[model samples]
Target: MQGDYQVISTLLPLENPDHLEARGIHVVRTDVTKDVSVKELKDFLQKFTGGRLDILINNAGICYTMPATDTEIPNVEKMFAVNVFGPMRVVRFLHLMLIEAKGVVVNIGSIGGICPFVYGSSYNASKAALHHYGNTLRVEMRPFGVRVVNVISGEVSTNILKSDHGRSLPQGKWSSTADPAPMGHTDTRAESVFYPLNEEFQKHVHRTPNAITPNQYAEGVVKEIVKRAPAAWFWFGASSTSIRMVDVFLPRTTWDWLFGRMFNLRKLADGLPSQIKL
Candidate 1:
């Protein structure tokens, strides 16, 4: 998009646009939760491209650290609105334009969606639903020659850390996604998150290794989009393959066992806790 194509990006209204505009990317203010946003995007694309679109990327997402037991219902709703509904709106409204250009729809999902987590039900559930939706879209849009590629991303070194639990968030416009709730000071402290399960996982995340940078992840995604025939599911980033294998071959309790060993949750329960198995 930097040199070859004109990139029109959407961000929250409060997000700064000057820097992105400086990079020659047209920035559109959009709140995916709103019904009008889809119409606005359609109009913009129509006026910009004469009703032909090459690619549609649904990248607007938000994550918060909390267990289902302690999470407020509205907060979960907000996560769904961003992660699931926002992308759904864009794809639904823009499908025609994509068909016109034989385009591709790229959805950025998470390994968290596939691999079970004791403490991430809200965020995890939203992503899992999204993964399923992308699969469904792929089958539905096949005849139209519109490719739906679900990028099941591993944890990348992105502002997601700050968005999930606001520690060390960079000042100015560093992230496309808005911080969900000022980070809630997410940290290794037991009080960092509400549920004990999530608190331990949050602590472990602080020390977890092998996360790739956002640029590397972006490079992989670009490579996928340019493929003549892209895979319906593509994965990359350090530790992603391991997690995907665990999700596919291991029982649900094994992932819980992992959570226990990583965060010392097992010590409190003698062995790997059975109660947290999903």
Candidate 2:
């Protein structure tokens, strides 16, 4: 980070670019979801970093919360585009620099991929795909001296969630998750069977109110990346360790029951008719 540092994102950091420029860090406005922007980034890096990149972090991601059946096709496609394909596109264009420098590729994944958190079906699937991609990429890149590290991240204080009005919540603040808010971009359809769970769905969106600060998560990730032999998958961030332990030790039925209770699924089940027409 001390030498030749640059950050690329679809959206620039909120802070004045001057602040980062003052410290010799340049921000490039690039979109990973587009191949043209990714190629442009590669071109910029070729000139800026002298065709050598020591580290590449695929941190661009987006999330939406809703029942899987209720999730629109476009929403699912968009999430996969940004969260899964975005990383793959970036790596495809930039892997040469990473290979030249014997560098590391870090994919910021989520624990939601491992745990069946209600209302995060598509978001979870995207992360699961990313986690698998990183693991396989590691094997493929190893021959070229490139290291791929996948971070099974947990909750962090970031504006990853948007309000029903399409405004991002506050960054690094608990206020973002303090009150339940409707997560769906559209209003719940009255005809949908899941309409009765609207309140619970909103609550699930704001479930992780006490998330770790971004700085805290970053510090741990940096440490892992700098290690001489970092593990293939590193776990860090709020509740990450606990969730990993639960996944490792708990039975599938226990996990199902726990998540059901956590997300109000039990109540919904209790209200349903015991005899099924099907």
Candidate 3:
């Protein structure tokens, strides 16, 4: 089965909806945060496929990188509305279609939730909330023969950096490693800048040697989604293994210290701006 891209209306520009239709891919804009929008999507789908759907993928998500010190309450609220509640709304609204076909429900999550990162508390927390929702929904939906799959992704080249972020991380500020350097290693690259540590975590992330491209990540994820007996959880792309490895091997306090040093949390927490718009 071909992968379908679900665009969230508020963030995506659907200047020409017909553009995608011409290519045999229908683009139905749905905003999971709004009940009205979700209802409208359900109505449209009922007509389009006669109230039957083989798969429902709740993949709408947003990310913001900022220290919790400067993360505005409104920003965190927005992230939760989309990343967590969004899935709940979509799955609830599409239950009829899903149950009709005994379809699969896919929730895209992040390793940030599984293994919290520095300077991205809001985004990480939002993902964690969604991850939990998937677990609960898996059991609830099982009665209807609907499978719920949680996709915990690693770093990938995606438009989220530009759409969700205000400023791009300077190409190479404090260089990380190409070969899995442990905590406390220091390296530098071109266009590197330090201070005002709000963007420190992001800078550290993008400067990494490599990340799986979105195309490759999508291919693997789609394959998993179509399995006869799909696994309840999945991990894909770069840094996914690293975080899992740390979680398995390190103690709670040790993991915290490692993230603190690797991300310069203390140094940046004291330097937070009054407010930063993510």
Query: Highest lDDT, which number?
Result: 2
TM-score of 3: 0.77
My TM-score estimates for the predictions, one after another, are 0.81, 0.84, 0.77
Give the alpha carbon lDDT tens digit for every residue of 1-278 in model 3: 13453322222344466645655566666677899888888888898778887877777777776555435566678889989998888888889898998989999899889876766788989999888999999999899999989988998877576544444333333323223123233322322233456365555545533678877997898899889788898887788988888878878677688887877766755543334212
Query: Residues 113-147, candidate 1, lDDT per residue (tens digit)?
Result: 88766567788899999999999999999999999
At residue 18, candidate 2 shows an lDDT of: 67
Candidate 2 lDDT over residue span 149-256, tens digit each: 999998998878753323222222122113332454443222233545666665656555578998899889988997768889999988899999999998867768
Q: Candidate 1: where is the Cα deviation over 4 Å? A: 1-3, 166-209, 270-278
RMSD to true structure for each model, in Å: 8.3, 7.4, 9.9
The C-alpha lDDT values of all candidates are: 0.76, 0.77, 0.72
Worst 10 residues of 1 by lDDT: 167-176
- Top model number, TM-score: 2
Q: Model 2: residues >4 Å from true position, as ranges?
A: 1-24, 163-190, 206-208, 270-278
Clashing pairs in 2: none
